[model samples]
Every structure is written in C-alpha cells, then in structure tokens.
Target: MSTLKSRLDVVEQKISEAASNSGRSRDDITLVVVSKNNPAQMVLDLAEIGVSNFGENRDQEAKPKAAEVALAGKTVTWHFVGQLQSNKAKSALSYSSVLHSLDRPSLLDAVGKAVADRAEPLDVFIQLNLTDDQNRGGIQTQNVLGFAEQVLQTPNLRLLGLMGVAGLDVDPRVDFDRIRNSSEQLMRLAPDAKYISAGMSEDFEFAIASGATHVRIGTAITGKRPY
Candidate 1:
C-alpha cells in the first residue's frame, strides 16, 4: 500500500478508537483532514481512498487547489480553516463550502453578500479564543454567542456551531470541556448549533471525548507538510 494511504488508515483507526472510548459512534464524528500546504494531487489521492472532507488554511493557496480538484471531477468538500478577512470574503467563499473561522461579525454581511444569489447557504463556525492571549484568531469565548446570533441574523449563512484552537500552554481536556460547554451555551440561543469543531491531530482523542462533532487532523493523516 502507498505510504499516504497507510497514514490515513492509522489516523482513522485512532479516530475509531477515540470514538469508542468516548461511547460515541464513529459516524457521529466528521474527520476534516487539513490539506493546507499539501498539493492537489495529494488531495485527489485521498479522495480516491474515500476522504471527502478536506480543510485548507489560506485563500491564495486554497482557491487554486480547490479548483484543481473540481476540474478533475472529484467530489470534495472544501473547508476554509484559517483567519478570515472581509476583503477576501467573496473569493474565499467561492471555493469553500464551509468556513471554520468566522470570528468576526463584520464578515457576516460580506459572506451573506457573496452567497446571496447562490442556491445554497454557506456553513459557518464562530471561532472562539480559548486562551488568555488576545492575539489569537478566534472571538473571545464570552463573545461567541453574541457573534453567533449575528451569524443567525444573516440570510445566507448557516451557523454550524463553534471552532477553537486549544491554548498551547494548556491541557487538552480543559480546552475541550470549555468548548463543549460553549457549544451548550450556543445551543440555548441557536438550538441547531450543536457541532463542536475543536481538536487537531494531537489532541483529537480528547476532543472526541469532549463532544467534538468535527476534528481537523493534518500531519497524522497527510504526513508532514512541506511548508
């Protein structure tokens, strides 16, 4: 078997075990393999192996890669998983079916305008800052619900719950628990918003146990990134 395929198998096995340990069905969790700096050919190879959900981080790199995959006739769900800017809202929305980093309310109108004429509404996650640091990309945890309500007010955007990066200096369990609680709080306002998109390749096991419906895994599945 190819090395990449083998790598994918290992990650899936880990996810399955994590789900089992959490007393949750593997079906309840969606593995969003991050393909940020990876080549489109690599993504196609993963598609051939039944990986339909892929996450990309940057607009400039992601747009062309998503186009390449589409041009090849492969059915892939592209997610934009980086910090978003209102200026690139339209272009970023053009290639992504989901944006995992909707931390600002200002981009709501931009995203709505971009998808206004489209047949489908865009799925967005209100990213939250889990650390005490203010330099991070997510909205403050306390402000997540307020921003989520704003997202709900937009006509063309669908609130898909919250996304966050665990603090580098903190414990995985703490961050995951906080995120799960945050999801519960968000649901009080937006009932349908139960999806928790926390965790990464390193802490995904803990994340799954904490009620993460979606996990963005990268190196564990795609091998080490070149960039």
Candidate 2:
C-alpha cells in the first residue's frame, strides 16, 4: 500500500478502537483530515478513497487549493479550521462548507454578511478558549454560551457546538471533558448543536472518549507537513 493509504488505514483502525472503547460506533465520528499545509492533490487522492471531509486553515492556501481540487472534478467538503480574520470572511466562505473557528462577534458579523445571499447555511463551531490566554483565538468558557446564542441567531450560519485544542502539557481528556460539558450546555439552547469538534493527531482517542463527534486530525494521517 502507498504510505498515505497505510497511514490512513492505521488512523481509521485507531478511530474504530477508540469509538468501541467509548461505547460508540465508528460511524458516530466524523474525521476531518486537516489539509492545512498539504497540497490539493493529496486531498483529491484521499477523496478518491472515500474521505469526503478535508480541512484547511488559511484562506490564501485554501482558496487556490480548493479551486484546484474542484477543477479536477473531485467533490469534497471543505472545512476552514483556523482563526479567521474578519476581513477574510468572504474569501473563506467562498470555498468552505464548514468553519470550525467561529470565535468572535466581528467574525460572526462578517460571516453573516458574506453568506447572506448564499443558497446554503454555513456549518460552524463556536471555538472555545480552554486556557486563560487573552491572546488565544477562542471565546473563553464563561462567554461561549452567549457567543453560541449569537451564532444561533445569525442568518445563514448553523451552530455545530464547540471546537477546542487541549493545552500542550495537560491531559487532553481534561480539555475534552470541558468541551463536552460546554456542548451539553449548548444543546440546552439548541439541541442539534451537540457536536463537539476536538482532538488532533496526538489526542483524538481521548477526545472520542469524551464524546467528540468531530476530530480534526492532520499530521498523523496526512504525514509531516511539507511546510
């Protein structure tokens, strides 16, 4: 098997094992292969093998890469998974069907305007700031509910629960549990918004155990980023 195919198989097996351990089915989780710095060809290759969801972090990269994949006639769901600049909302919205980093009011407003006339509502996750870092990209735990309320009110945006990154040195399940708690709280407001977007290359197993419905994994399956 090709290295990419081998790596993908291993990740899928691990995901299946994680889901089984969590008392959930493998189908319950959506694996978003983060194609941030990876090339479009890699995405196309994966798509050909039934990987329908791919994630990109930068508008500059995603724009051209998405275009390339589209031009090649491959159909894939694009997820924008990085901190977004308000001014780039239009650009990002143009290609992504899902935005995994909807964190602030300014971004919400920008996205609202950008998708006002689109035929489909953009699926979004309210990013959570797990730490006390003021410079971090997500909304703090205390403010996530209010922000989620705002996202629910916005036109052309579908709230998809919470997205977070566990602190590098801490146990990942701690952060994953926090995300699940927040997701439960969000569901009290909008039940359909119960999907938790957490975990990555190193900690997806822990995330799955904590009820993460969507895991954004990259390097483990995509290989070392060329950049």
Most TM-score-accurate candidate: 2
TM-score of each: 0.96, 0.98
Q: What C-alpha lDDT values do all the predictions have?
A: 0.88, 0.91
**Per model, how many backbone clashes are there?**
0, 0
Instruction: Report the C-alpha displacement of residue 1, candidate 2, in angstroms.
Output: 6.9
Model 1, span 172-217: residue lDDT tens = 8998899999999999999999898988989999899999989999
Pairs of residues at least 3 apart in sequence or in different chains that clash in candidate 2: none
Task: Indicate the residue-level lDDT of 34 in model 1.
Answer: 96
Residue pairs in clash, model 1: none
After TM-score superposition, what is the CA distance of residue 35 in candidate 2 from its true location, in Å?
0.9
Off by over 4 Å in 1: none
